[model samples]
Target: MTDIALVRVTFDTAAEADRIARHAIGERLAACVNIDRPCTSIFRWRDVVETAEEVTATFKTTITLASALAERIAALHRYDQPVIESWPVAVDTAVAQWIDDATHA
Candidate 1:
């Protein structure tokens, strides 16, 4: 695995997803944020099953910054408990280098 990380977040709307993506890139906290097509999410919340349309995004960044990026996303999200997950990932050497440069302040 490379030193790069992939942070995943789900937002209620497309607008919210775009906003966080732009913010994270502008802050140098992420190299790229891929806002995926809307998806249906099913899970249990407050002891009840719920289903909703959510915009998912995958943020590329150095593993060192993953935690900070997740925290920032959580703070800026509208959901009372936004879903944020992250983990280190494997990448080719060139891609890893690009991620490193892109996330640097």
Candidate 2:
């Protein structure tokens, strides 16, 4: 495994997803972000089960930047509890090099 992670975050809207993506890339916290369109989300909120449409943003970056990226996303997220998850990325030389180049640029 590489010292990198793939961060997954879901937002209430496309605008929200775009905002987080731009901020993360602009801050060098992420090398790139892929935004997925609105999709159905089923979860419990405030003791009530609910379903809502949401957009998902997946970010690629080093583990060292994960905390800062999460903090920034939380600060800008509209939801009281945003979906922010990170998973370790298995190393792939080409992809890892691209990530390093993008974040360092």
C-alpha TM-scores of all predictions: 0.95, 0.91
Give per-residue CA lDDT, model 1, range 13-52, as digits (tens). 9999999999999999999999999999999999999999
| RMSD of candidates 1 onward, in order | 1.0, 1.4
Global local distance difference test of model 2? 0.86
Which pairs of residues clash in candidate 2, taking residues 3 or more apart in a chain or in different chains? none
Local distance difference test values of all predictions, in order: 0.92, 0.86
Give per-residue CA lDDT, model 2, range 29-78, as digits (tens).
89999999888999998999999988888999987777778888899899
Candidate achieving the largest lDDT: 1
Give me the runs in candidate 1 sitting further than 4 Å from their true place: none
TM-score of 2: 0.91
How accurate locally is residue 84 in candidate 1, as Cα lDDT from 0 to 100?
93
Model 1 clashing residue pairs (backbone) = none
